[model samples]
Target: MVTGGTGVSGETAETGAGGGEALATLHRVFGYDAFRGEQEAIIEHVVAGGDALVLMPTGGGKSLCYQIPALVRPGTGVVVSPLIALMQDQVDALRALGVRAGFINSTLDFDERRTVEAEFLAGELDLLYLAPERLRVEATLDLLSRGKISLFAIDEAHCVSQWGHDFRPDYLALSLLGERWPDVPRIALTATATRATHEEITHRLNLPDARHFVASFDRPNIQYRIVPKADPRKQLLAFLRDEHAGDAGIVYCLSRNSVERTAEFLNTNGVRAVPYHAGLDGSVRADHQSRFLREEGLVVVATIAFGMGIDKPDVRFVAHLDLPKSIEGYYQETGRAGRDGLPSTAWMAYGLNDVVQQRKLIQSGEGDEAFRRRAGAHLDSMLALCETVRCRRGQLLAYFGQEPPAEGCGNCDTCLSTPETWDGTVAAQKVLSTVVRLQRERGQKFGAVQIVDILLGKRTAKVIQFDHDQLSVFGIGADLTEADWRGVIRQLLAQSLLAVEGEYGTLVLTEASGTVLRREREVPLRKEPKRPTASRSGSSGSGSGRGGKSKAPAVELPAHLVPAFEALRAWRAEQAKEQGVPAYVIFHDATLREIVTQSPATVRDLGTISGVGEKKLATYGEGVLAALHARTPPSGPAPEESPESPENPESPQSPESDWPEPPDEPGPEDWD
Candidate 1:
């Protein structure tokens, strides 16, 4: 047994429990029979007083790694998190499992905070969740000094990396945890961290000695699709109507106004939706988030501000109305869907403007040269993903330094149906030639639209004023529509065959473009797929079709069992409403589906369902059994109450939503 070290004075040093005991507790306390990937090893390491760095996917059981160790170890487990909204829900969920957990943040009053502090010093808490900012206060540190900490679990550890999309300066101070309490073990966890971000986290958090447990970063159940932005609202509506009509999901926009308008548009069109962003009053944001967690089939149209530390696991899809800045940000944002191991969709509609806006923001930002360069690299990776002709999953996983699965994942848009590509050398030459001509011969720098107008011989005001009509290239692309010309231009930009310069996004020839003009390079472009009309009766494409339906949900209860499933869902919702807790907190949809499928006839039978810990089984088992009984057919033979199936572990729960409130730093626009 590892004895106490420097910080162990006046504190209990309980020997770490054996694996048998840990397994027993898993079934007794949390009602799981087995540990997930690397979980058992992680828990044993931390419980025996070893440090660790965990990089698991969103729905992977991260909390359990820390939570179980806290129970198995001698003292309170302190978790440093970012979001206040997630804190209460997490504490609530843990308490439901009969664990004594508390959190101290802005959400609590002085009296409440003091009480939690007192409980901590007395060694009464199994877990204590705190925001990173709380660690900055001297008094808070002083309070921690008086207690025994089993281990320090840093949630969303990627925030410590400056290059991380959700970077928080306060997280940098976490390095002191190692120095201040040299005896205590620490585990830093994140769902999204690339190779660079991973190294930075280890170095920044003073966790150089910690074991790095990098789980497969694949969320195979979420289908990835990227579409061209054309009437975004209509596209989104058609997406929802076709495939995900009654499903719970999130739509992320790049701006607050877009969030509001999209939410309103969805609601007006009969989709229950809410808008969430930093610009909204804190109370309103909280209310909307609470409603989203509590309601079924609700969609939240939000900025990137919405999802961090949000633990609602049944979100059916995540749709991006605008392009995110980097692949890491996209992965983190899209990982919020299909958390329950159910098939979900990750959909997006990005266009030329998204490219221009993101690039312009990066180029003009106040960051130092290195920072801007890194940002540009990140943006370039995301662009490549949008334009890639190969398997998206392969590209996405390869970005994280992992080999893609041997067989292509058939779940993404590319694998379901390969997108067609066209030889674009002629189109590229025409666009590049025009830029060279306008700059060298005409001495005129023009944007894409003006160049397009000159090519199609539109004789628009700008074209006429520039006398571009007299050029040999004028009307040369008259056969292509305005959109087609624009597509060609954007494709050129994407391929680095052209570049957008300065504040106005004017087209400029890159060194790479010179080859195309000289007929030394061939350019290939993605062919834009035909967009489905509003009046079209079917889904625009595969994955998310009309009625917002995917091929199947995470939970596919038998046809005869769906009525019982609905009954149990209704009962859970009612219980949640009465208790003012999110329905998932009472019992996740997965658990209910298990109960419905098993047709549990009594409390004993209900207790066999996954997610039914001893405490929860005692509290809600009777209610769940009754709900099942109400829907059981009269002629059906009642199965005897079966033995408790301890191995039926539910989909890993994610009470930690990671939408860190936009940090106090400069907003995205500040850079540009």
Candidate 2:
């Protein structure tokens, strides 16, 4: 590793792990006074030249792991990204903060690529971001051997694993990053990953010794909703029209064609809509993405390509057209919204075959048999999520190895709907007994659908072939709907009461399930409501807060300050125009509410609100305070003012004029 000559802080250095001096540089350079979650831990490790793999949430601040260290460390940090958009987005944000950041991807021409490479050679860059495909170039690897690169960060590192939904061949080349730069610390970061995926990432990146910093997967800010995929289009329209009206949101579809159709359909309706997917021309895609990011109230109907690196924080909702392949994909997509920590929603629709079709696709794919099997299991888990009557957030978090200890989150559909559950003691016993009887005779060999059919006394071909229909437990339980029965068996497997024997394992009674077979005790089976397929637009399209109409138009300020508020509102509009950003972005309703409540009369007084930091207060305080001081005379009927001036109280020379007039009038009256 090269010892520092000049650092990203614009200062010369000669040390190793730059210590508190580097941290000071970070705070100054990044404008953040403190770190969030395990940022401090991961930063410390990478700063000390140790490898790390951070699994943080969408807004968990993963970029700082490499960013802060890049400025303080001895060499440029090389971030391996999969998308050109991701590199450019981060580069733009960093440059805004006055950091020397640039990226090279397929989007650049040969000349542009050459220019950035020249800067890399001259050590003129702080953070150098690259597509993993770019790193595969012979010249690129050769340059890495020569240049002073201290950190190799693989963003969206989950792509490296076959287990992840967004698997890419280029990402597998990440192992070369560590192999090529053995001494430098390599940190892999992703917003979503299961335990299995974490292992695959570790092995593929060759960072087995890396520290794993796993943040809580909970997006308590995001309200999770799973509407049945009945009339999804109408439901989506109704949802947008009713709840998140005039706000930026996404409607995700499974196919590029679906994306376009959805976007057009939305446009035909009242919403401002645009379509985005890989099939669109690059420029069109870029323009659409740019509009969605930079402007508010533009809805983008898209596939997975639309949201990998979106940093726009105020996305009001994320609606899915078809089901996502796995819960991980779903969470990450929905997690894109509500990153600003204001309330948002994750809404999706799915039908029965949506699950079957995805499962069929995975099984039919030509990959490692093990990989296909894993995909099937993942699909099952996702199906479980779609069919689950429990807290959707809880199920999602649990899938990622986090436990939710609440009776209900109260924010998800299941909690709000309160699915009635009852003693499955007898039902579970019957199901387990059937599994046991079948296993005792043949083995744990069949899928849940097959097994459920056998227990419900359906004399199908497979059951007849195995003589399972003749079993005593057969026909003992058929009261539940296919969906309901499937849910119970799924829960049993999830709770470790049953196990699949094959790749994902079919239902075989586990030791716990065996207890139910022996009539040891009752098992709780949730009796989900007989809900009609909730049309996509059929959801309770309430505001992000509890229920009913949003407290949005808060009883228009105080009557006394209403005119002052109007003046402030006009000033806000003017400022918004000058800045060329949305008025809400410049100052949210929360900030306006503060201004109305405080009615500060001076710049300093306006700056007293917590939201008005020094920089903003300096820039906007005077105008805002001036508006507040420009009071209106109040309202009922307009006040009429007297024409008299309030200055002089005495009538001017009235007596003198009267005497002069009387002398002329007296002479005339005497003649008459």
Candidate 1: segments with Cα more than 4 A from true spot: 1-19, 535-538, 541-554, 634-672
Task: Supply candidate 1's per-residue lDDT for 583.
Answer: 77
How would you encode candidate 1's per-residue C-alpha lDDT over 400-464 as one tens digit per residue?
Answer: 99998677777788887898999889988988888989999978787777888888888888777
Q: Model 1 Cα displacement at 195 (Å)?
A: 1.1
- Model 1: ten consecutive residues of lowest lDDT: 3-12
Task: Give the alpha carbon lDDT tens digit for every residue of 1-672 in model 2.
Answer: 110011111111111233475556544554233455576778888889999999988756677777888877887889888777656656754554456778888778999988888888888888898888987799888877777886888888999986565888988877877776789888999999888789999998888799889988877758888764445677677677656767788888876766777888888987899998877888898889878865657899988877886766667789997778777888889988755455688888655335434544565456888887777677778877765667888888888989973797878877777666788777777677777777787664666767678767898888888888778888877787666666566556555576555433355666677677667767776664454543333453223433222222221244444566556657866875675443433444334555765556677676555334444556677877677666645335533333522232221111113000111111111210
Residue 580 of model 1, lDDT score: 78
| TM-score, every prediction | 0.90, 0.69
Clashes of each: 25, 6
Name the 10 consecutive residues with the lowest summed lDDT in model 2: 1-10
In angstroms, what RMSD does candidate 2 have relative to the true structure?
20.3
Any runs in candidate 2 off by more than 4 Å, and if so which? 1-19, 22-26, 363-365, 422-672
Which lDDT value does model 1 have at 151? Answer: 90
Every candidate's lDDT: 0.78, 0.67
